[model samples]
Target: MSRSARAIAVNAALVLAAGLTLLPLAWMVSVSLMPTGEASRLPLRLLPSAPTLEHYRTLFTRLDVAGYAANSALLATAVTAISLVLNSMAGYAFAKLPFRGRDALFRTLLAALVIPAQVGMLPLFLMLKGMGLINTYAGVVIPGLASIFGIFLVRQYAQSIPDSLLDAARIDGAGELRIYRSFVLPACTPILTTLALFTFMGTWNDFLWPLIVLSDQDRFTLPVALANLLGEHAQDVELMMAGSVLTVAPMVVLFLALQRYYVAGVVSGSVKG
Candidate 1:
């Protein structure tokens, strides 16, 4: 093939792939506005014969998706906030602080990363149940409070900070917490934003743990609620699509906003490793 032909072919392939990937998402939105039974008709139509938001209304009013949305928001926010604090503390300590067995301890944790979190999930669930948090938001929040990967991400980024800066702070009588809050936090803003985005999205999209722990319908996160909605409203294609859209929209927006930082973190970590 000629060079231009090859380039044209590559561009065409990329456009095809993008369309393929977006097809389902596009269909979801289209069907969300479709009349109740139109999506499941004899022919697969790309659009509603007559578009409407009635299904969205049903989700918010009768189906009580608003509650599920609130639960999802609360859980995602809580997990992100808690993980930020814990991960930053552990990460900063690992990077800058001199302590007994620091390298060994971090090494142990690095090894622990090889262990699937699922391995400990059984015991963790039992522990949470014993504490009466099984059906509560706290149950969902506990396991994600500190992710090994989150800590490692922050640590790798923190290591880039000059030792002289920390030493200067120490000599100037700045306490560890002060240094962390004022200096480290500012310096780590990019990664912190990235991690917050990661944690929030993970928590929002989580299905298994939330499915296992939360038994109450009132406390169900959006994903769990959507699953439940699927059970009763298999016939309501428009409503299901609206629920899917709501469930996906926030995380997508967040990712687009912080994608640069997230991608940068990935590239930096790969190079460092």
Candidate 2:
């Protein structure tokens, strides 16, 4: 094929692929807007005969979805903010600071990553229970405050920062914390943005940990609350779709807003580190 033809072919294929990927999400929104029985009709209507916000209204007004959403927002925000600081500090230390056994400790952490997270959950749960943190938001946020993967990502990106910059800051009488605040954080912005997106999405979509930790219905996050909603309203297909949309919408918006930074961070981190 000629070059122009190949380019046209590739673009067509990409458009087709994008449409296929988005079709389900489009259908999901459609179903959520559908009247009560419209989604489950015999023909499987792709579009609602009469779109309405009834299901969404029901979710927010009667089902307390707004409260659950609030809980999710609070937890996700807290986890993302705290984890970024902890991860960035640790990552920078690993990359630049001369500390005793730093390499060994980092290596050990990497090795631990090979072990399944589920394996440690039981002990972690027990430890938290002993501390009387069970059924609290802290229980959910504590475990996610520092992750091996987060630390690794930050360390790799931090390593790409020129050593002379840090040395220059130090020579000018900048303390370690000052240098971190003024220089390291700014230089690592792309990676940090990427990390923030990952952390927020992960925490927002998390279901299992919240389910295990929070027994109170009022304390439940969106995912856990949605699951509970499913059990009680299995036949309410439209309502369920609305709930799913609510749960998913925030993350979609977040990703869209930060997409450029996210892509840049991933590309830079991979190539530089």
Candidate 3:
């Protein structure tokens, strides 16, 4: 094939793939805007006969989706902020700070990642229950305050920081905390932003743990509340679609907004490695 023809072929394939990938999301938006009972009609329609916001209104007023959204936003934000600090400190220490058995300890932690998270869920629940954290935001947020993947990402990025810079800072009589605050944090901003976005999206989308921990309806996150809505409003397809849009829209917007940082972090880490 001619180079021009090959390029045209590749572009056509990409366009086709992109359209297929986005079809469901487009359908979702269409269905969400559909009038009540329109989505369940005999013929599957891509576009609503007449768009309406009744489903959205129903979600906010009747289904209390706004409250659930607020809960998700609060929990996800808190988890992201706290985890960034803890994970960054641990990752940077592993990368730069010297200590007895530090390599071995880090290796052990990496090995622990092979274990399924579900394996500890029961014990975690029992421990939280003992501490009276069940049915609370703390319970949902505690387990996610640090993750193995977050540490790994940060450590990879932190390894790129120059040891000479840290040594110079120390020679200048900078304390460990001062060095971290002044130099390390700024250097790690791209990776930290990536990690923060990851944490926020993961926490926002989490359903099983929140459902298990938070028995009260008032404390349900968007995902958990959406599941509950399915149980009570199974026939309300339009309303369900609206709720799904609300549940997913924030992460979409957030990723779009901060994707540059995320991409930069991944590329930097790959180059550093």
Candidate 4:
């Protein structure tokens, strides 16, 4: 085929794939706006005849979804913020600083990534319980504060920084923290934004860890609360769809807002590393 024809064919295929991927999410929003029993009706209505916000109203007003959403927001924000600091610092140190056994330690951490996260959950849970953090937001946030993948991502990106720049900063009597604040952090903004989005989305969508840690209904995050909503309202498809929308919408908006930075970070990190 000619190049122009091939380009047209590829574009058409991409559009089709994009439509297929988005169809379910579009149906979900459609169903959520539908009247209570409309979603469950025969032929599976793709769109509502008359959309309403009543289900959304019910979620916020009656179900205390606001509280659960708040919990999710708080935890996701906390974990993302803390992880950025910890991960970036560790990454910069790995990339720039000369510490004894640093390479070995980083290699060990990378190796640990091969181990399943689920395997460590039991021990981690026990450790948290011993610390009296069980059923608290801290329990959820603590484990996510430092991750091997986050550290690796930051380290790879930070390695792209010029050593001469850091040396110059040090020659001017800049301390490690000062240099990191002024030089490293600014240079690493793209990767950090990417990490922030990843951490936030992971924390927000997390269900198993929160369910395992928080026994209190009031402490439940959106995903956990949504699961509970499912159990109680299995037959209420519209209500469940509304809850799903709530759980998904924030992350969608966040991703959309940071898409440029995210793509840049991933591309730069890959090329630099």
Candidate 5:
């Protein structure tokens, strides 16, 4: 139809979609503030009769959710930092540096992306056990250091960098590492921030791997701790919701903070590709 009509329709659709997406999160927050057993009552109320922080208090004081939050933050941050370095270096090499069979090797790794991650878990677990890394933060962080998608993102973005710029640096007798550190890294900031956000959110939400690696109660990340909370407090729906909120809040805050970089990276990569 008309231009203004189309614009109005699109805006309305976006608002509708936003509301639908936020409905569950709203319900989660509402349920978390609900008094115990109020959520289980008939008619399924969305708002609590009287909001209470009892569940939250119980979570922090009795359940020690702060410790789990700390563990998740530590592991996710470490994974994000390490993964950015490894992925960016490999991605830059794949994009800029020519090597015998470089394209072939990168393609092979891309092909590996089609395989399910779960398929490698058994072998990875065995390998980690052999190295005596189980029950350690290193065990959780090691597997996440390099991701095929992260490499692909950086490679695609790095390809947008002008070869002439790199050539000038090389002609100035700058070493490969110096060129990468001084120029390449700075140019890749948008994509690197995006990758950091991705890695952090993924690591923070990871449950199966961390649960398998860490057995100590104190070492459990928020997701694993929340799952444990479920096993023991299945009937305490409000308490579980509170834990979920705690687990998810950091990711929401982080995404909001880095959304500009994340969107810029995606747009840049899409245009460059």
Candidate 6:
């Protein structure tokens, strides 16, 4: 094939793939707007024959989806805040501090990442149960309170900080905590923003662990509660779409808002490595 022909083929293939990927999102919106019971009819309807917001209304008013939405928002925000403080400090210390066995310790923790978190999940659930954390916001908030990737992300970014900065802080009577809070943390705003986005989105979209831990209806995040909603309201296609929208929209918006940071982190890490 000629070079021009190959380029055309590649572009065509990309467009096709993009369309294929977007098909479900398109269908979800279409099905969500459809009136009470028309999505599963004989001929596939690409758009709602008569689009309506009744399903969205039902989700908010009758079905109590708003509660689940609030739970997801609060849990994600809390986890993001906590993860920022814990991971950023740990990352900075690892990057800049002089400590014995620091590399070994970080390596050990990194190795733990290879061990699927799910492996300990059963024991974790039992441990949480023992602590009476299950069925509570703390249960949802605890596991994500810190993450290996978060540390690694901040560490990567912190490694870029000049030692002169920390030395300057120390000469001015700054403690380690003070140095981190004033110098390192602010220096890491770009990456911290990136990590915050990552943590929030991960915590918001979390399904499995939350499903296992939060057995109480009141504590269910949007994904878990939506699953339960599916069981009872499978026939409500539009409603399910609305739930899917509510579940996905916040995450999509967050990524768009902070995409610069996410992209910067990726690029910086790549160059640093």
Best by TM-score: 1
lDDT accuracy of residue 122 in candidate 4: 96
Query: Which lDDT tens digits does candidate 1 get at residues 36-131?
Result: 889888877898899899988988989888899899999999999999999999999999997999999998998887787789899999898789
TM-score of each: 0.96, 0.92, 0.94, 0.93, 0.90, 0.93
* lDDT tens digits, residue span 95-132, model 5: 99999999999999989988998899999999999999
Question: What's the lDDT of the predicted structure labeled candidate 5?
Answer: 0.92
Pairs clashing within candidate 2: none
lDDT of 4 at 76: 96
The runs of at least 3 residues in candidate 3 whose Cα sits more than 4 Å from the true structure, single-residue gaps closed, are 263-273
lDDT for 182 in candidate 5 is 98
In candidate 1 the C-alpha lDDT for residue 93 amounts to 92
Distance (Å) between predicted and true CA of 172, model 4?
A: 1.4
3 or 6: which has the higher TM-score?
3
Give all candidates' CA lDDT scores. Answer: 0.90, 0.92, 0.91, 0.92, 0.92, 0.87
> What tens digits encode model 4's per-residue C-alpha lDDT throughout 1-273?
999999999999999999999998998899999999998789867889799999999999999999999999999999999999999999999999988999999889888887887998999999999999999999999889898888998898888999999999999999999999999999998889899988898899998899999999999999999998889999999999999999999989998998987787667656734
Candidate 6 lDDT over residue span 1-273, tens digit each? 999999999999999999999999888888888987788787878988888889889888997888989999999999999989999989988899969999999988878877887898999999999999989999889998888878888898898899998898899898988888888888999899988877888899889999998988988999999899999988777788889988888887888888998787777656734
Span of 10 residues, lowest total lDDT, candidate 6 = 264-273
- Candidate 2 whole-model C-alpha lDDT, 0 to 1: 0.92
Tell me the deviation in Å of residue 99 in model 2: 2.0
lDDT of 2 by residue, 1-273 (tens): 999999999999999999999998998899999999988789768999988999999988999999999999999999999999999999999999978999999999988887887888999999999999999999999989998888998898888889899999999999999999999999989889899998999999998899999999999999999999999999998899999999999989988998897787667556733
